[model samples]
Target: MKSSTMLKAATAVLALAAPAAAQDVTLRIQTHYNPEQTSGKLATEFVEDVEAMSGGAIDIEMFYASSVVATVETFDAAANGILDCDMTGGAYQTGKNPAFQFVGDIMGGYDTPYQQLSWLYYGGGKEQAQDLYNQFGMELIGWWVYGQESLTSTTPVAGPDDLKEWKFRSPPGMETEIFANLGASPIVMDFTEVFTAMETGIIEGTDYSGLANNQSIGLFDLAQHATYPGFHSMPSDHLACNKMVWDGLSDQHKRIIETAMEKLALRSALFFEKANAEAAAELAEKGVTLHNWSAEDRATFRKAAQAAWDDWATRSPEAAALVESHKSYLTQLGLISQSE
Candidate 1:
């Protein structure tokens, strides 16, 4: 071979090799959960799993405790590609898109964790939710439930009447409406603000996760009174990815992410259950009293909550259908009463 021709071939080979060697991509994973908390741990684990699964072809940089973005801002950040992933509540973004409220609006009807999980993954619930998200230019990658949330307050609450004269911290939409129906003054604020608000008495009480999560944040320390059976959030927590980023991944990468999420979901559900149980015991040790609602009192509260739901449903046909669908599902499974 001529020396010039040989030199040209070597140069071409190096050029191709250089491009391959320089291939690098990084994804930012954001969430409001504390980095040391279960949700944050799982998120970080998912990032690691993604890195491992992709063999370092894709690097995920995780930002927790809303460092990169606040919980309420996650949806917009992810949709706009400011962040590549987020574990957030679909309903918190209701101001951006009403359809996100569909999740929170009908969550009251899920009787069990298994039921909610089934409905979300295999029962076409996720697809419908994804359709809603896609409209906002994001995708619903995967979601997990962290069980129900109950009220933690400075004063013990056994009935709706007890809720009066209390300012309760609540999320937007249905939750606010529910609190209003119970006669509690609703305080709308982001989750991060709840701790400080409670500490400074900006709010008298807040509806947060089960015992363990609250304990981690010292929420139980601020409010010694805890109520059982959070009718509002029969289930809580969500995990999502940016739509464009999700679609841009290879099929194999998508499968890895989804599978990792499923495993993480199962782990998280169990973790939440165990944590709440343990936290209940710890609360007693720490002088926090747990109050379970009496049958009549619960019935009364439910009736009032139902009234609120009815009012909301009447205001939005889509919300009404979601509530009815979940109700029908529960009725068919004998988890709830078919009558009224």
Candidate 2:
């Protein structure tokens, strides 16, 4: 009888230990950041945190700098199961729908990273982004707005008027239109070509990335004129996964990823703000001219960008809806005039 009781106690102990002994899941995630960059470091930290939080049951296999797939292809790759998760920006998916532009860039809409982050979490941005991603068979896990992007130029660019007759590199969609409105000839090219194009005088400037990222890449060396505390673009980098994969995750695993991403978002934003500031000072020391637009100039650019926003909203019902959501949120936060 004592042997029977011992056997039952051992069985209960094994059942309790079963979950801990479960096989570990390693998700393959891809990013556009190289290992040395701020974003890359944060992504690594996020991976570590997830592993710790999941008690080693979850692991991340990270691929950097589009090694697995190009930035533009990450969304489709993740959706198709070639990649379990993609840490690229939503802007790359603009080719899929014009609505993505509203979700991705928003041109002159947001003044600070925190404002946009708030809209994504507290406002309707999260739901709208999820809806858009669902249409593409991907899941929107989370996003980070690191910092504003600066324009690097061989010549000075103070405001919209200064862009006239200038040649610059820009991304596709509404950004090209905005620069076109300023009378600059916008060249759409892959980001990798910016340095060579600038060196060969193929283009005079580029609105590529944040100050620190540009500095790290030596953009300031070729283009002496740079904009600081940039007012133009603040792209939100996303953490997305295949919808099926995301749905299949255990509740504990899903929460770990979501919580880790939220921590990363806030941490990256703060890190970039300080990093960009330091880069500005470093560039100034290196004899590079940095320009910060006046309030009047910013207002002028914002007004022009509003016209472009209105034009984009008319492109499709989805785009129109996204714009309206942004506008309403901006108004509630007093970032924009309600009548405007």
Best by lDDT: 2
For candidate 1, the lDDT comes to 0.73
Task: Give the Cα lDDT of each candidate.
Answer: 0.73, 0.89
True lDDT of residue 145, candidate 1 = 76
Instruction: Report residue 167 deviation for candidate 1 (angstroms).
Output: 2.9
Give the alpha carbon lDDT tens digit for every residue of 280-321 in model 1: 887888798888777677666656666665666665555566
lDDT of 2 by residue, 1-340 (tens): 9999999999999999877444578899999998888788999999999999999899899999899988789888999999999898888887788888877888888888899988898998989888889988888999888879999999999777789989999988888888788799999998889989999999999988999988888887788898888998999989989999988888889989999999999999999999999999988999988889998888778877888989988987788888899999999998788888
Counted clashes in each candidate structure: 0, 0
On TM-score, the candidate that comes out on top is: 2
lDDT of 2 at 85: 94
Query: Where does model 1 exceed 4 Å of error?
Result: 1-25, 104-107, 189-203, 314-321
lDDT of 1 at 82: 88
Per-residue lDDT of 210 in model 2: 92
